[model samples]
Target: MKLSKNFTNPLAANNPVIVQILGICSALAVTVKMEPALVMGLSVTFVCAFSNLIMSLLRNGVPSRIRIIVQLVVIATLVIVVDQFLRAYMYDVSKQLSVYVGLIITNCIVMGRVEAFALGNKPWDAFVDGVANGLGYAFILVLVAFFRELFGSGELFGIEILGDWYTPNALMLFPPMALIIIGCIIWVHRTINKDLQEK
Candidate 1:
């Protein structure tokens, strides 16, 4: 049951994006398009999950003074590997992602999990927490991208769903629109979780 909570909580109630607001930069940058947002989400998921597992395994041996450095080393290695894989397998999408892929190294969601949870939890639990938080972040990204791509471009994943008569909203493609979408998401999230609003 505890493991399930680790995996499930971040999906909604404890969502890293809507609640903690840890990874808003990528949320704003990548959601301009659906495909890049999806790729970025999966990349972040992989990095967070694996890094957490590795950190949990090494937690006992890591020197307290240098644990942050150690976590960075692990995270950087994973980010590089993810970047190389994207370049080789999905070159065009990777090009779209650009520096944002490398920026995953600086994503607070990744480091925060390692420092706050992985360092204290068992490997399996930490892995679950990482994946859940990654998905939480991804969920918001995909939601925002879906709206942005659909209304902004009159398409979904590059395929037009809106007919020729339908005109796209150029504002949805902008960074400010991402913020608006995110704000809407938070409003809805808090409305449903009234306990969050109480505090």
Candidate 2:
């Protein structure tokens, strides 16, 4: 029951991508390849979840005026830790992701949730909400990456699927494609979850 809630909550209702429009920069940029996108997604999940937990723990004593600053320090520390870990163990992927990994510190999704949910919740519940939102953002990201990689490179997870004759579409690799795919996903998501549009 917990796993179901964790994995599925982000895909709709409180979807980080659609409902919140969080983390779209990474959603557009790193999604050119499946493996990289997956890694990016997981990294965001770890940072967001842990940062939420830590922030929730400190919420009570944090000065109301400095709460935003406190949240940034915690989030940045986690991003640096993740960056160092990725560099030491996964250098190639780290290089590909480049500044984007570091930029996670500024990702609105992280800060937005930290301020809105984490500060108000118990530590464990904050963690769950963070993971759920991160995964929800990732779900839309990966789904877009799935199509972009498949059509743009004729591959998924770096495996050729469209045969040799298929010429990959260069346009699909660009950010515009990400925007289009996200638009379509939003359209469909809103259609099914019509309450969002009404709101």
Candidate 3:
């Protein structure tokens, strides 16, 4: 794939969340609010990009029998680093993210790109792909978080947006609402891209 495509495609045409439907767990878990969602998104982006880069660099040297193990190690190391950084600086958000930060190690989006793209592509290309996909994931997360926080809590990033007269929808803060929001996003995306609906 061209470098531009590697960087741009995932933002829309190949979005990990809306298109590929990967990483939905974190999307639902952390998006009850915006701050944790933003933190989680950036942390995942960092992990995905660096892990892909490292995996690409080691692709040729990794023994076929142990490549998956090697990829997990790299991903785990990166996730630990991100977790530690969040703990140190964004302690509250870190606590809010809790296990989900560690769970990034198990995210299919990270593993899939590392195995399917980084293993066969150049390091830079892999890095771009990872970052692009991460951003795609982040974009949907933020979008969902925006609505959830806005309607669920009458706020955005903890700043109150709705007036005292406004009544928040309690259900919007729940996991089922996340699935509904994501479903709506997928519906709109497919509606706009008619080719995506063709079977």
- In the predicted model 2, the residue pairs found to clash are none
Poorest stretch of ten by lDDT in candidate 3? 1-10
Give the 10-residue window scoring lowest on summed lDDT in candidate 1: 190-199
Q: What is the full ranking by TM-score, best candidate first?
A: 1, 3, 2
How does each model score on TM-score?
0.98, 0.94, 0.98
lDDT of each: 0.95, 0.89, 0.94
Candidate 3 residue pairs in backbone clash: none
Most lDDT-accurate candidate: 1
Per-residue lDDT of candidate 2, residues 49-151 (tens digit):
9999999999999999989899999999999999999999999889989998999998898898899989998898889888988888777878999999999
Deviating ranges (above 4 Å) for candidate 1: none
Model 1: per-residue Cα lDDT over 41-78, one tens digit each: 99999999999999999999999999999999999999
Task: Evaluate model 3: give its TM-score.
Answer: 0.98
Better structure of 1 and 2 per TM-score:
1
Question: Candidate 1 has what TM-score?
Answer: 0.98
